[model samples]
Target: MKLLLSLSVIIGAIVMASTLTCNVCNFRFLFVCIGSSSTISCTGNCSLTQTFAGSAPFFSQQACDTNCVSNTTTQKENVFGLNYVKTCCSTDLCNSGNSAKLSLSLGLSMLLLWLLKCV
Candidate 1:
């Protein structure tokens, strides 16, 4: 029984240490955002050519494109360009290097305690 308990504790510690050492990033579907810039008119030799009077800038469009993952995706506020993203994003568990290390330490400690109880 003691041998089994010791083995379990060691295995648990190893597993926890390995598992908590990796980074896991998860993403979820959110909403969509619809925005339009003022009409900008353009003059061209060809009458068929269409001109934008006040079309949105490239940066604004880029931001919208980046945030707008899909057609159904929308957000509370429509941000233009690379100004700011209104979507919610937070790092938990395996976020940055430091955060992951801290999580690993805690997990290892917990595994050790559990192993002790088994023994």
Candidate 2:
């Protein structure tokens, strides 16, 4: 019974670790967000969207999305001369400006150790 309880706890930890953490921010004129940026944890994917004015990037937003679709559209608004690119990824901190990679390595490592102890 104790072994089953330990296994359950390890499984729960792995599931919790898989939740996506995205950088949530809105910026204008540059992708390097001008002001403060924050992070959000969600069960879905992380999205990074950028809007362009003519050929120059003018706006950007990053957030946790439930049903984000990845795509690029050109000349979305001819009158406003606007275009956009959106990307969605299912990894922790994927929408952050920095290229740091966060994963369930620690959780998996713990699970492996627990299993070895059981054996």
What is the TM-score of each predicted model, taking all chains together?
A: 0.21, 0.60
Q: What is the lDDT for 104 in model 1?
A: 37
Model 2, position 118: C-alpha lDDT score: 100
Candidate 1: C-alpha lDDT: 0.28
Task: Give the per-residue lDDT of model 1 (tens digit) for 1-119.
Answer: 99999999999887654332212222111111112212121211101111122342111121111122222222232343222222211212211221112243455677699899999
How well is each residue in 1-119 modelled by candidate 2, as lDDT tens digits? Answer: 99999999999999898787888876533545544567888778888888888788777778888887544434376778788778888888877774222234544565599899999
Candidate 2 regions off by >4 Å?
1-11, 70-75, 98-119
